[model samples]
Target: MIEMIEIAPKVLGLRINGKINEEDMEKMLSVCKAKMKDEERIAVYVEVEEIGGISFNALIEDLKFALPNLKRFSKKAVVSDIKWHEPLIKVGDKLFPSIEVRHYNQDQRAEALKWVQE
Candidate 1:
């Protein structure tokens, strides 16, 4: 399941857990686009917990949505217990120099949120 967490004017905070389907991805994309319409540059905070899996269609949608909107994001904070995600985010930081990407363990969720809002 994927749902919106906090709704700051220029920030998008989400909590994603369990399996993610196309509907979930579509809803997230819709909300993101709507938020982007109001704010030029937004900060994103994502908290992932016990992820079962993600559908291929959702993954494809994510790629399609992310590529074009990369420039619209100022900062992204990902909080997850998944160890591999940290390194992947680091790679993304290197690849997308314009956007600041950071990863935190599940325990540091509050810190992640604070940093993203800053």
Candidate 2:
């Protein structure tokens, strides 16, 4: 499951708890795109509760959405306790250089939000 919200004027918050299928991903992207219609850049705070994989179609859809929004994000904070999340996030940093990606442990949710707000 994917829960997405605009925590601030231009800050997007997301919580992923289960497998993210293509339909959910498409909806998430649509919501975000609509929310960001007038804004050139945004900040994101994501918290991962469980280890979930994305569908191939979801990945393709995500890239389609991301391609045009290359420089749309200013900062992104990911909160996850999973060990592999760090390396995965690092890879994301390489894929989307527009945003600065940082990973914090689940215990550091407050800090992560604070960082994203900055």
Candidate 3:
């Protein structure tokens, strides 16, 4: 399941609990694209409960949207229990200098949301 959380202006929040397919990616990209049109840049907060699977089509769509618009993202906060995510985020922070990526434990969801808005 994927749901949008309205946290702040120009900040997009998403909660992902299950498998993500192409349709989910398309829906999210549509909303994000609309937000980008009005705000130019945006921050993101993602709370991941469990990712059962992701379709290859969804991955491709995400890459298409993310590659060219990397600079359009100011910050990203990921909240999950996955241990590897922290190191991955650190690497992402370096690779995408324009976007600051941070990882937070699932218990720190509130803090992640606050930080993403900041």
Candidate 4:
């Protein structure tokens, strides 16, 4: 399941658990774009309660959504308990030095949100 955990003007927060399908990815992209319209730079906080693989169509949608917004977001904070998730996100930082995406341990979720707001 996916939920909008919080939102503040130009900032958006999301929580996702279990497997993510193409519909979830599409919905998330729609919500994010709709909420962030007219904003030049966006901040996002994503809390992953659990990690599961995405569907083939979801993977395609994810790439489509992310590639366009790679430099549009000022900060992207990913909160998760899984240590392995860090490596996956760090690759984005390497690819896009303009926008840095950080991984926060679940306990540091508040800190992650604060950094995103900054």
On lDDT, the candidate that comes out on top is 1
lDDT of 4 by residue, 43-104 (tens): 88899998677888898988888888777778889999988888889897888888878999
The segments of candidate 1 whose C-alpha lies over 4 angstroms from its true place after superposition are: none
Would you list the rank order by lDDT, best first? Answer: 1, 3, 2, 4
What is the C-alpha local distance difference test score of candidate 4? 0.83
The residue pairs found clashing in candidate 2 are none
Candidate 3 residues 60-118, lDDT tens each? 99998899999899999999998877787898899999998889998888888888887
The lDDT for every candidate, in the order shown, is 0.89, 0.85, 0.88, 0.83
List candidate 2 stretches off by more than 4 Å.
Answer: none
* Candidate whose TM-score is highest: 3
State in Å the error of residue 24, model 1.
0.4
Evaluate model 1: give its lDDT.
Answer: 0.89
- Candidate 4's C-alpha runs over 4 A off are none
For each candidate, give its TM-score against the true structure. 0.90, 0.89, 0.92, 0.90
Candidate 2: tens digits of C-alpha lDDT, residues 51-75:
5788899989988987888688898
RMSD of 4: 1.4
Q: Go through the candidates in order and give the clash count of each.
A: 0, 0, 0, 0
RMSD of each: 1.4, 1.5, 1.3, 1.4
